[model samples]
Target: MIKVIIFDLDNTLYNEKEYVISGFKAVALFLAREKSLDYCTVYSSLLESFVINERGKNFNYLCNKLNIDKSIIRRLVDVYREHYPEISLKEDIEMFLLELSRKYKLCLLTNGWLLPQKMKVESLRLDRYFDTIYYSQQDGLDLAKPHPKYFMKILQFYKIEASEALMIGDDPVADIQGAKDLNIPYFQISNELDDNEKQKIMQFLHNNI
Candidate 1:
């Protein structure tokens, strides 16, 4: 039976795109105030760059476009990473988590820079739902997702075998593969948990646990 439910933070619990857009807005506002640039223009440029390249150098694109010093790119990155993200969980999520928390030991295992990940967790107030939270970077990037170290750590902490835990996440390679490598049962989920997705998860739980 499944006694532990491990969740990925970025795309599993909340919409990660919302966090990205929120970070971009924060950086854009900072640039506007510091460089006296147009806020909308800067925001649009950042969004366009992100859309085109996904996770490419968005700040570099903005710096090149605005003829700003490349040295300031570091500051822009810091602004984006350290910004208090304006993000929210889906309307159904609070109830879902509340319900799950009663039945299973909910833990969060997310891979990202420590500061930004912690900020995201704080913004979403995930501590209320999760019994334990593991930031992969806290251990080291080398032991991040797809390595299975953190997954093993979570299991060890809960004093449960891998079979007693279920890994729920969006990333096929990072989240799913990590759990797989650890011989843990896992459920692949979408970035947004719609009604159908929620039903599917419930069915998976019914079948597995």
Candidate 2:
């Protein structure tokens, strides 16, 4: 029986792109005021850099593209990552979590910087729903999901067998593969679910999980 439900924190629980867009807007405004750049241009350029390079490289990419000094990259990246994002759990997902928590031990396993991920949890007011939470940066370097040790750590800490846990996440490689590596069954969330799909999943949880 699945006694514990482990969730991925980013796109799984809440839309992570909301956090990215919030950061981009903040950075755009900051550059426009502090550096005398055009707000629209700065915002659009940052968005493009984000899309092209994804996360870590965006700052350098933007700076290089705009001929901005390398020194500014750190500040921009810090602003992006450290900003308090406006995010929340969808009402339906919130209800699902509430219902699930009543029956199963709910925990979160995520891979990211500590403060930012924690801030996301706080912003969504989701801290109360989770029995335990783990972050990659909480321990040592490179101890994130996709690593078997990370999955094993959670199981060991909770004293639950792989078969007794169900992992639900959006990432195929990180969440699904990590769970599979340890022989734990998993559910992949690809997109937003409608009411009927939610009901079907709930039925599956009730009947089989």
Candidate 3:
């Protein structure tokens, strides 16, 4: 009797790697232009830096490696965070969401900064499909996933019991364990978006609901 479906937006609905690559390209282009370096070289450097350094400190690593002024790192960081990303759901996902919306109330729950997450939803036109959306930063409760209260707030809002809701997501801790903490059902998958995964979800809904 799953009446509601909660989706983790980033790696669940769409491939988060795509968003990261888009941001990298933006940063690469900016660096190439400013430093008179080849765009491809800058892009490769940024990618390598991303893998080795903490995400927030990637710009510092890039600046140190490229001998670029540290002052400009702030601007680069802003570009990486604020750049408009090219993102969209796959055809299978679009159709699945359309079908799911008809049968179950769908809510998007994600952890991230408020504005950027909203922008991602807007860019992909996902805002229309969800009944309600929750962002960790915007919820005013400072609640983050893996915390029971985070899921509790949503249940309270919809007036639904934990047994009546299902969470589908890619993160074990943030999405799956959080729901499990309350005896809610959940399905976890690898953070890649693929037709096989979408089909599995559709099948799960059919069998379980």
Q: Please report, as a residue range, the 10-residue window in candidate 1 with the lowest summed lDDT.
A: 190-199
TM-score of each: 0.95, 0.85, 0.86
Rank the candidate models, highest TM-score first.
Answer: 1, 3, 2
Superposed model 1: Cα runs more than 4 Å off:
none
lDDT of 3: 0.83
Residue-level lDDT tens digits of model 3 in 42-149: 788778987877367777777787787799878987887888888888887888888889999999998877777888988888866899888876655457887777
User: Can you write out model 1's per-residue Cα lDDT over 1-209, one digit (the tens) per residue?
Assistant: 88999999888888888988999999889988998989999999999999888876888888888788899988888998899999988779988999889888999999999999999999999988999999999978898898978898888898999999999999999999999998898888877667787787788788876
If both were scored by TM-score, which would come out higher, candidate 1 or candidate 3? 1
Model 2 lDDT, residue 138, Cα:
82
* Location of the lowest summed lDDT over 10 successive residues in candidate 3: 135-144
lDDT of each: 0.89, 0.83, 0.83
Off by over 4 Å in 2: 51-57, 64-67, 192-197
Q: Model 1: which residue pairs collide?
A: none
Which structure among the candidates has the greatest lDDT? 1
Residue 193, candidate 3: Cα error in Å is 4.2
Best by TM-score: 1
